[model samples]
Target: MLRDKAVTGMQLTLIIAALLILSSIGYAMGRRRAVAAGRGGALRLHSRPSYHGAYVALWCALPSLLLLVLWSIAEPRLAEWLLIARLPDSIRALDPDRLGLLVLDVKNLAVGNIVSREIDPALQAAAEGYNRFLTLSTAAMVVVAISIGVVGAARAIRGVSPAFRARNQVEKVARNIMLAASIIAVLTTVGIVLSLLFEALRFFDQVPFFDFLFGTRWSPQTALRADQVGASGEFGAVPLFAGTLLITVIAMCVATPVGLFSAIYMSEYAGPRFRATAKPMLEILAGVPTVVYGFFAALTVAPFVRGVGESIGLSVASESALAAGGVMGIMIIPFISSLSDDVMNAVPQSLRDGAYALGATKSETIRQVIFPAALPGIVGGMLLAVSRAIGETMIVVMAAGLAANLTANPLEAVTTVTVQIVTLLVGDQEFDSAKTLAAFALGLVLFTATLALNVVALYVVRKYREKYD
Candidate 1:
């Protein structure tokens, strides 16, 4: 069966290669004819010879590509239908899932893969039937696709003339393709939102929405058997929110001042040579993977924080939020710095000159002129950094232990919404239960929050932009 599938794939690939070759031939023919119709001068043509070539190429490729895509999508389901019909009545009477498993086994068996059950005469016969169907389907696809490509190319080539609007045709097709791509993206986002909403609603049905939103505890494990110990499925999300807020605040505290300062220095003070060197070095911090930061926090920062706390007679968890947040802040610094620097540099130099004309010192000029002018952009950058910190998972997962503590203290371990979402969905688990569905709920909430944050940021940016502009 595997050999048959491989052969079918090779045949399809060859069809695609042949279509491309035909398109290329059509392009050469169309260009030559357009030049001939224009009396060997492209200036006399209605459109450029290149446009004529592209028009012919698109004609040759699009129909065949569309056919190949449709065939690939429908081929498997059609194969399955044929196989099911070949199954014995007794086998067909099996439960839906069991029958599906049998189909899967037959496919795997035909491909020379090990099956769960022993190979029987019926299974062997079904596998053979499946191979035959696949071979016939692939052969049909090759014939139809090649024919479409050839016809499209021939029609396009024959239609080429000095008066032909090849540019308009090609541009219209390109515009339609782009519009289709955009619509697909919009529909995909809607699908995601609807999926999350339905799954979150299912979770809310099992667990009270108010409790999930406002309750302080967040134990999501519902005991399957009543006698199971330590399975109090209290799905309070307040603690998770609080932890996320605490860590975010801590990260901002570390990132904001440092990033802003670096931006100011680089934009207003540094020379061209120094700015070129320093900017890339600072931006390199952003390129360092979060996992590497996680390791640094876990192996180095966590221990150092613990030692400091101990010296001061204060207790610190092995996986403290302080360590995680601080490291996360370092990771986000480049985002704020790079953006803030660009914004500051964008401020008109005339403003600074006018400030200096008023006998303002360099510091005074920056404070009164440059700072105000760049404030909106700086705030936007900081908001982006905050969003980054909130969405960060690896650093928190590795350094801040998964203890959803509802406290402001950075010395204790705490978990964020992302961490909890990952935990709930990891490994094999029942999806119908509130536990699995909670991941969707968390994702929905996070999505809503990020959206709200973006909206607010945009408002602030616009307001400040008007004032500055």
Candidate 2:
């Protein structure tokens, strides 16, 4: 059993290493054969030696890798079916759920995990059989995979000739791989949208769509017992929407001007040395982790804001939206500054020269020509920053309290859609309940809102770009 366990652990690594070694050998052989074919200028090859090498390597590795993947996926299910088929008649005659639990116990016992039932003779025999099957399957996989790789390499090497279109074949394969990747990305996005839509539909069946959308309360706790408090939970999302908008507005107000002014200074006014030194330092803020930003907001910025508010005779919650929004704005500064600076720098030097030739000062040239020309990209950067602010979870979780108060006051405790989504889905959850499904509803709405924002931003960008052009 120990030997079987050791082999199972190391077999995958060994198989991959062996395949790599074979591919390297095939490449060397193919390149050598190509060079010999073109020796003494007797015949010119249609493709380069390197392309021939790559062709042989691809043939040597791709088939074996595919077989390995398929085998790994099928082996477990096959073994489990065989194990259940060989079980005792009494065990096989049990209910489906109980039989499944018994099989699970057998597997756990086989893997040295604590099993729920006693280790009887039947269970021990099943464990042994299971381990034996896995060992045999792994051994067969290694042999078959390597044998296929050798056959592929031999055939590819034999096919290599002066007239073989190795480059075209290799390029075709590369194009197919890229196309597959693009298809996978599109399918993945479609899958996400469908999953959210289906789950949110289920939630809407339980809670009215209008009530969820327009109600002011945000409590999601459902009572497990009839006499429990808050047996009927509110799913109104207006408070969450209000909080998201308030924080996003505050963040944009702080980020837009500071980030745009910084970009303008770095692009137009600062000397080369100063720009080079300051740009990286400013962009470094983006690399700082969000948890660190959350900590700073909770421990430092929140207290400072509360102190100032009280000094001025204003009420301030310990976890107000102001602190979270301010810190979030600071964290997103680099998104705007870096992108806007790059866009402004990309403006044609001829435009500046033309403006100066017309007797415009530096400031006048920037205001009249440069800013107008870069407005589209500047708006793009701000849109990206706004999206960042809306999606932020950690900062709001730490610095802003999870009280979904539908208020415009920044000094009050509030929570956004993302924060509520996290709150609803935390820990063990039953997916059939409205409490769990509400998270999906919130996610769908958030996705729609962001998509709408993107459409508007694109419209504004196109309009400005047409005017500038």
Candidate 3:
């Protein structure tokens, strides 16, 4: 089959491009109408004319865009059915798995992909016909959309009766759009929670919740054949919890003092010039990719930690929990510093002045007044940072070992829930296996933990916001 000059996605893109061009043309026409009215100085323009332009633009764009979204979603399903319906009875008679493979080959061949078999003319024609149908549909959509846009724009301009209330309509539309956009936050959270919940439910089906929760072993290996030798399928999460806890504690130890002090200095002690220079410099930390931090943890920080431990007459594993957590803490410092700084700065200047009037030093004013005023925001930011550290995967993956040794010792190599999840899902495995399902369980736990942290942080911030506002 000779492929079309334009693919389906590209065709849709061109139609969108045409719609934008038509919208621009409509805008220009509306502007011209406004100029003509102004020149005549007889019939007053009902609206500031740009509103008429935007009205036309919305007409030109919105319906077509909505149709495109709907069409794109439905096209694949309809096309698959169309192809499957045309398959020969012999091919259709194949088992489900084999039928899938046969369909794959037919699709590949229709796309001019090299196949061992000779050319199939029937399939090739079907593909070409499908392409033609799509192109005609696209062209028709664009033309109809533009025609409607032009007609609608002309009518709106002509019927801009006195008290047409163009501005009110425009404001009403914008308000509705803003409200819809705000719902995206809730939608995203809901989608993520639902996905994790479903997967965790699947995991729970394979491994009993009590076994996953209360059992002490952490082994995830299980044989495909039940008769196979030596395949222990233990599913305890205690070590992962312990490892995560130990690292999180070490990370807080490293991050809190450094981040809080830096924030304090920047907010309270630094000169205007110093604050300007330092704030961006500190935020640069947040922008640095976590992957770079992973390598730094594994290569640079791990060795230094081991050297320090050896000097102190202690044994430190090359891939110790401390190495990963310490680096992860450094990676998250900017989150604490930037957020705390904003909250501290938000504290009313009157409070600072009042404290100073009481003959307190700058340090005393900040420590007693500003810090307390900002404490809720500060705690919120800390909780946010802790959630970040807990969900962190890469630094731990590279620096922390895979052994699920349930130990509190930071110097010992330990694995986390995330690391085990990665290990379970790394290679190709049966999705139904306990190994693969275990990742979902781990993910569900992580999601639940982070969600809890966010709830607490929001509550704290909201309470403080109510007090101050």
C-alpha-based local distance difference test score of model 2: 0.93
lDDT per residue (tens digit) for residues 1-469 in model 3: 2353347667777877877887788777755666565554534656676776666566656666777788678765676677777776776788999777666566666566665555567657555655555566667666765666566666656644433556577678788889989899889989987887887888899889999987778989898787876577999999998898888888888889999999998888789999999999989988888889989999999999999999999999999999999998898888889989998999898888898899999988888888888988888878978988888888898998889998988999999888898999998888877789888889888888887878878877777753544
TM-score on alpha carbons, each prediction: 0.94, 0.95, 0.89
Q: What does the lDDT read for residue 232 in candidate 1?
A: 68
Which segments of model 2 are wrong by more than 4 Å? Answer: 1-9, 466-469
Q: How would you order the candidates by lDDT, starting with the best?
A: 2, 1, 3
The alpha-carbon deviation from the true structure for residue 425 of candidate 3, after best TM-score superposition, in angstroms, is 1.7
For lDDT, the strongest prediction is 2
TM-score computed on alpha carbons, candidate 3: 0.89
lDDT of 3 at 134: 55
| Error of model 3, residue 174, in angstroms | 2.6
In model 2, which range of ten residues has the least summed lDDT?
A: 1-10
Which residue pairs collide, candidate 3?
Answer: none
For model 1, the run of ten residues with the poorest summed lDDT: 460-469
TM-score, candidate number 1: 0.94
